[model samples]
Target: MLTLIELVGIFFFAVSGSLMAARRGFDMLGSAFLGGVTGLGGGVVRDLILNQSPATFAHPVYFLPPVLAALCVYAFTPAVQKLHRLVQIFDAAGLGLFCMTGTMKALENDVNPVTAVLLGVITGVGGGMLRDVISNVTPDLFNPRDVYALPAILGATATAFAWHFDVLNIAVGTGIAGLTFVLRLASIRFGWSVPLAAGHWHRQPNIPNHGDGPRRNF
Candidate 1:
């Protein structure tokens, strides 16, 4: 069950990366690379932190999804580009699934609940961060106007809570992940967002006259 969930998440993430590469006019090799990184980077980071071998290396089949995703994007670039809404939906699904899987894996490894939730959020957002950085775009996580990380945090926290109470199972996990996915989509659809930097909200107090001449924007 866990493996299946992870693979589905990977495929969705790979599709998102492939779409980005296609939008940027990347060649086949670049598309494949971006897709692979977006699909597997987060899990690799999680495994390394847990002192386990990365699953993408351990299971050769894990490499197939990104390659397949890239090929599909390359073949149908126009159609795929026109389906931007669908891509966002898949990305949200990937975000929810990865966070749930990451939390479950951490708990399975005997990690504390708090750490598990943290790892879950990392697993949810890390791949997208790497993809954005490599593609020279701003990461969604760092985009103050996006609610990307909040859904993942909620999903991870729910997973950890369920696990702690000995009530986590495939069904409950799926429901929680679905809720997370919905939250993400709703945020995008409704323009829901976290507040921007504190400075953006609150004005700095005026400096005293003893300060240098006219106060300038910092």
Candidate 2:
């Protein structure tokens, strides 16, 4: 059950990474590198923190999907970039699956519910962050306060709560992941977003203008 979810996530994430590379005009090698990192990086971090072997390292077959995804993108070229919406859908799927899997694994290792949810969020966003960093862009989840991480965290927390109550079987996990996926897709379709913080640099001070001052033109 665990490997099944992980494989689905790996495939989705790999495709997302390849699509990004395609959009950015990266070469075959670059696309492969990005795909591999995006597909495996988060799971590797989660496994190491849990004191277990990374799936990609332990099962060599786990590495094949990303490589295949990258090659497909490279072969398709600009045509693949035309279907940009497909990328977003797949990315959401990846986020949902990865977050749940991460949370479940953490709980299996006897981690507290809070920590498990945190790990879930990490697994959900970590790959995209690494992908953006390598591609010379700010991570979208943090810089702009996107709805990405929030949905993942919400789903993870729900799953954790269920697990705490001893009701978190594979079915419940899948449902939680599905909820996250739907929310993510809805966010994209409806232009939903989290409000940005009022940074000091962006705040405008209210200054009183005396009658002596000329009124500003609209």
TM-score for each prediction? 0.89, 0.85
Clashing pairs in 1: none
Per-residue alpha-carbon lDDT of candidate 2 for residues 68-181, written as tens digits (9 for 90 to 100):
888777676557547567667778988999999899889989999899999988888888778878877767686663578888899889878988899988788889989999
Kindly give the number of clashing pairs for every candidate: 0, 0
Error of 2 at 167 (Å): 2.3
What's the lDDT for all of these models? Answer: 0.88, 0.83
Over the stretch 1-218, how does candidate 1's per-residue lDDT look in tens digits? 89999998998999888888877778899989998999899999999999999988989989998999999877776664465675577679889999999999999999999999999999999888898899898887888777999999999999999998999998999999999999999998898887666765486776687757876785
Candidate with maximal lDDT: 1
Q: Each prediction's Cα RMSD?
A: 3.4, 4.9
